[model samples]
Target: MARSDIRRSAPSPRGGKSSKEQPRGWRLFFRRLFVWGFSLALIGVLSLAVAVGLAAQSLPSYASLKASQNEQMIVVRARDGTQIVSLGPSYGKWLPTAQIPQVMKDAILSTEDRRYYSHIGIDPVGVARSFYVRYQQGKFRQGGSTITQQLARTVFLNNSRTFGRKVREAVLALALEWKFSKDQILELYLNKVYFGGGAYGIDSASRKFFGHPGSSLSLPEAAIIAGLVKAPSHYAPTADADAAVGRAQVVLGLMVENGKVSADQARGVDLKGIKFAQEGGQNSVRYFTDWALPQLDLLLGENTKPIEVWTTLDLKLQNSAASAIKNNVPAGTQGALVSMDRDGAVLAMIGGTDYVTSNYNRAVNAVRQPGSAWKLFVYLAALEAGYTPATEVVDEPVTIQGWSPHNSGGGFAGKIDVRTAFAYSKNTVAAQLGNEVGFSSVASMARRFGITTPISTVPSMVLGSNEVRVIDMTRAFAAVSARGKSIEPYGISKVTTTDGEVLYTHEARSSVQLVPENVANGITDLLQSAVSIGTGQAAQIGRPVAGKTGTTTSNKDGWFLGFSSGITTGVWMGRDDSRPVAGLQGGHAPARAFAAYMKVAVSGRPVERFQTDMVAPAFQISPDDEASFSGSPDEYYYVDENGNLVEPPADKTAARRPSDAPEDPAPGPDDANRGGLEAVDPPPAASEDFLNKATGKEKSDGTPPN
Candidate 1:
């Protein structure tokens, strides 16, 4: 600032020598301006040179990174080491130059790179021709992405189809040219391109589209496979056979034009009749894969990219389950099945009534209220809290915190034993027990048994008000069948690289015992009674079996969950529109379907009997028989020979109340309205060993006990 200021202040030099001699100051100023402009120009040239040098030095590395990364693909294999699926960049396999079919090579070269072998990596003639054609079309239509350029874009670059990306691709293509030989780049490109439909490499496409591997493709098939490179879905054999043939014809034309095939040979080709499997299309097992994909992704996280998920799914079991539902469930009814081993390995899962029509996977996706089946948890809570199976519980109508529960049939049996109450699904009894044992305890017990959904500790919890997925409920019941161990279901067993490098392995978590063996056995015994004489009669298998039937209120949902010695199977029937099923109670079609599936699912396996513990506290003459007094309509009371009622002390006065303030009113016409009927809740009808609550004492005269 000071120098410029001084110069400006010094001013324009006007020498007085002569007017013609004139301004020496102006000449000096012009000379200085010229020098400054020259210096800036030299600096600009140096900067450009430096930038070019830096790019030249680092560009190769970027191109190399792209090439290497794009070449490596993550192959997902089954536990048996078979490639079940893959997420690769290419549509085909990476084979040596000689392994690729001559027809396929010729087809790709004739269509994609006419001068692939002649030119380095780029062809200026082709570029100019394509440029002129696109300009004449008034749109950016044609692109001259050489084989190398296409490979570069696929393996290393973003999928931006813009001019800048195109330019970058071209630059990378030339860089690849200088880095590798023509055959090397071609081989890499052939193995690293996408043929669409999740077919990453050329070998996969040949196997998928032609029903043959890359090494076995016929001329016409190879031509078609090569044609798919242009647009896979648009010209896919499955999507449009005629269009694919048309594309093949264009490829054949190019082949002949490039001298790769004779014109007569191309014309004589009668290869227009290729067809693909319609059932699976190019994507086989879409339903099963879609179902397992999210689960696999969640379990393996970053490792899922290359991991294969091998499930315990028996294809036969799946087919049988689906067929059973189709054959039995009424038309317009939707259902699902969850079948698992006693060890918790899910053998088969059928999500919807039909996965083909609906992608809704009801096995794991749909969460519906479980209805009375949830009573199992309430019973489990009581059993764990030192309550024996013979424990007496009143079945009278009771209210819990303002929620009055009605029986499934709208009546109570007064008092009942644990087994009868559960087997009969006495709603009032279950609610009373749920409240007595604490709803939180029941909810906690359900959680320990693998119910992941939120459980509410309300009185309705006893009625299966909690929502649970079919799979979750199946897994929970599997614990009982598994002999008191929790079984977390899993699909994939192991994962490895394509080259057999062991990447990751999934080990089964050891069985966790969440319930005492005796308690679980007791629960299973009670459920066995359900199948034998109670609500789950439809689940009666010839062999010893145990299960529970669940029919939610209003027939909105029905379920049959059961287990044989070997497998636990759950069946659900409902409607997609959420309409009530037509007479579809849990004990009806759902239980029948479950038994039908299990009868075959567990065939040939010897039954392993459930173990029960007798160490539980024994009651005196069965708690259900603590009192017995028969009354008749004639106002007659049949008293036992010993004394008042039954089992009374000698000194006790049976007819006398304590000498208190007031006595109970006598039975009279007006007393009935005054609460003087003296209706005492009778004890559960005790039997010699077990009591039938309905008939007072287990029918001593040999009337069969309920």
Candidate 2:
């Protein structure tokens, strides 16, 4: 019994462990394996937390993100609601979530992420597919970022392909998803999204490209805007219209597959209608926009919020003007053209031959000599003193302050009426008229016509001897076109934000008549003769045109400025360095271009004839003028087809009066427009090929083809 008890009591367990005893079986192996896995998983979780913490530290806040972008971009639009240009970085008012078109949202979701609502900040299925694509292609070719993730990256991160950036993007995306609702995240994303051409935010882009708000977007328009997110520069509607349409079609197909719209519905959306609203816009428009940029501060008062400047620029007219200058301005020189309404609203401005070649906005900036074009004021001064276009004046040579001024053609009719003298561009008679009217009165007349440039009160001031901007010159003529009303040249008609809040609006003030009605009518009559029977005949376009030609000595500057079809336009030609062009004339290519541009600019507008009839104060003709009217008034001169100063043919002279003779006349030109040289009214030297662009026929020598 003692031996059995000892064996039982000391019964050493079996070689292997029992079920409840110290286990040495699969259970223990599994327990140890689970413990090791748990510890490793905990370590990995902590490591991921630390990495995410580091990434979150660098994330940018909304305020900081906004601060780095453009303070306020200026989006200029034409009067017809076409975008002229987009300048500065786009930072605009937030577009409400409701205003974001449903179609646009659907299009984005379909193209970017199908499971956007259900997916976490990081899309797992997308990640798997991305990984598969990487494995198959041996590199990361596809992205797995959800909408939330994209927003995080756009707001907080620079575009970098580093793995660390990817990790940070994921962490920030998670943080965004936790902090904001899906709609809020989407709103933020759309606002910060860059759609190119300095466009940011869907609303700004909509106004920029469509000339409307996002809330009014059509289906195809929405698809087009949505498609821009992938490759902004490559797919911007203005950049590559065809590519943008194709991408939009692809987006539509994706939308169809995603069930946002039926296949029929998507197909019904006209991709053909997805055109950019910036019609008639060209790179040359940079000149106008550049001119308008500085005025923003004046209009907006230091408010740098994104704004839409509604300008008076007519893009269609602008394009025509640009084409006219491009086709007419010859090599080795530059040209500028500006057109405005009768009330001084600037419609079009072309600064140079090519905006790419030079951005010097000669229209608004360049202050150059205006030559005989200043005769408008001289004649206006004479009219104010009761001189009519028909009033008689002796066309004899004159000397003023020891300066002798001669005709551009080097001759003067022995005795002629004032009309004959002015029509023939008789310089001697212009000097007589300037002396009769008083030089200060002539300068005052110019000032009254809105000429802000400094006009010398000296006797030479009777000739256009002041350096002036093309716009200012155009403005002076514009006042005349408005029947002697005071003019203030303005471009911006209204200023608004991207959300349609108007900041500034152009107000039409009371019209200030710079001249009496009769004087205005008399001056208009004089200008009419200048274009009809004078040097500016080429500027006529199947209608009554009234303008003047001005050429500085040595042809340093050539100008054709006038009014027709209720619009006042001006064209200037010269080298920027003020070097002489051998034979440039105000009536040459400049007149041709004015006609070319006006032909298109006046199309579809009602024909408005000039007010020629007026009550005038009768003035007695000087005894010498009365004496000169009788001695062979038939000895009138004209620029024949050969550009020579020749007397009319015997038969033509017998049949024609001085008003019927084609005369390229000039005003007093001793102190020629700020050119500091004697005014020389040479015949047009470049009319040979000027008509080919408009009439499609070569002109005969230097004669006008019309």
TM-scores for all candidates? 0.74, 0.64
Q: For model 1, how does the per-residue alpha-carbon lDDT over 1-706 read when each residue is reduced to its tens digit?
A: 9998998777366663334644478797888889998999899768745643454455555344323543434444333444545554434445777998788788888888888877755688788888898889976565776898887787668878788887667666766776678877777776667775656567877766766678767778878878888898788776778888888899888898888889899988876666664423212233445555566555655652233345555665666787767777866888888888866666777777655578787777788998988888888767755566777766766677899999888888766678888889898888767766566656656765667666666568789987888887887788888766767766555555444555546676655555556677888888888998899988877887788999887798999998887688888989877788779899998888887887888776897776655343222234454233121111111112111122223333433234452321222343211211122221122232322433244443456646
Worst 10 residues of 1 by lDDT: 629-638
Task: Give candidate 1's error at residue 661 in angstroms.
Answer: 34
**Cα RMSD for candidates in order:** 14.4, 14.9
All candidates' lDDT scores? 0.68, 0.74
The residue ranges of model 1 lying beyond 4 angstroms of the native Cα positions read: 1-92, 135-141, 159-161, 275-292, 295-305, 387-404, 411-417, 617-706
> TM-score: which candidate is best?
1
Best by lDDT: 2
Go through the candidates in order and give the clash count of each: 14, 5
Query: Candidate 2, which ten residues in sequence have the lowest lDDT sum?
Result: 676-685
